[model samples]
Target: MNTDNTLLNAVIGAVATIGLSFLGVSPVIGGAIAAYLEGGESGNGIRIGALSGLIASLPVAVILAAALVFLPLTGDIGVAIGGFVLVFVVVAIGVGFTVALSALGGLIGAYLKENA
Candidate 1:
């Protein structure tokens, strides 16, 4: 497989993810497409997929970071702390979901590539 193209493929997949997300499609499809394009082993596919997910989530991470930073400036300390924790948890879960699903999709894509 051409390992050199992995990053490019992942970027394409991230673009796909961003585009399809507007239509309510899952990021898994994007991940699968990336791995399929890479045509590598499962491990490599996972790496590509995870990278894609991470790339796609960059804007989200930035927004979440902003929220975290600014939330503390609002009103009471107790409310701010609570808001911070909630946002943190939401960010963690969202990132985790994207990465995990993308990895699974990569595995599936690799399996498909091997069999087909």
Candidate 2:
């Protein structure tokens, strides 16, 4: 209910996202719930949502990074470079996708909160 606490709201949203993910719900719904609870302007909602998305993505990023790091690399320098590049591209795209979806959800949630 405290709209000023952006970090708290984002954490709550990330929790919601993790929970909803188990139930097959979209992360967008989690972001919307977070921004709705935040109860502020759209910009604030966007911030909260993006932060939440980033927080939620942290675990996935860590796991992916670990996997890439622990992978046994052949002696070929080109293959090692290509592998790292591929991992980087995948992680970047995934984070971007999640953030974009959450931001859109935040916008929608702000509108709904304002209207209601």
Candidate 3:
């Protein structure tokens, strides 16, 4: 992996993460959207979304890490690809974290509602 590619990926990831956060569309929302798109039931959407998001994000992280650690290239081509992959991974991880947090929030909300 080229040092330039690695640095570029990191920069792109940071920018993308910030952008998504500002859009009020975290990974959890993306995950929930994905589940809904797949025809998941409303009752189970949150859980399914969380699981799917987590699973999906792992590959993204791996790919980004691999690009930084394994792929050997230089110049604009490498930078472009690395930037794209890095952004993708950041989005995926954001979605996963959001979904997980949403799930936990739901559970806590439900427990409180029930107990109250």
Top TM-score model: 2
lDDT of each: 0.80, 0.78, 0.46
Candidate 3, overall lDDT? 0.46
Off by over 4 Å in 3: 1-75
- List model 2 lDDT by residue over 53-83, tens digit each: 8887888788778767644466677787788
- TM-score of each candidate? 0.87, 0.88, 0.40
| Candidate 2, number of clashes | 0
Give the winner by TM-score: 1 or 2.
2
Report the C-alpha lDDT of model 3 over 1-116, residue by residue, as the tens digit. Answer: 21223223223333333345555544444443333333323444445445544544555566556655433455567776777687667766665575575444333333333344
| Model 1 per-residue lDDT tens digits across residues 1-116 | 43468888888878888888875445788788888888878998898888888887787877987897878788789989999899889888888888777777777777788788
State the weakest 10-residue window (summed lDDT) of model 1: 22-31
Worst 10 residues of 3 by lDDT: 1-10
Query: In candidate 2, which residue ranges exceed 4 Å CA deviation?
Result: 22-25
Residue 44 of candidate 1: its Cα lDDT? 81
TM-score of 3: 0.40
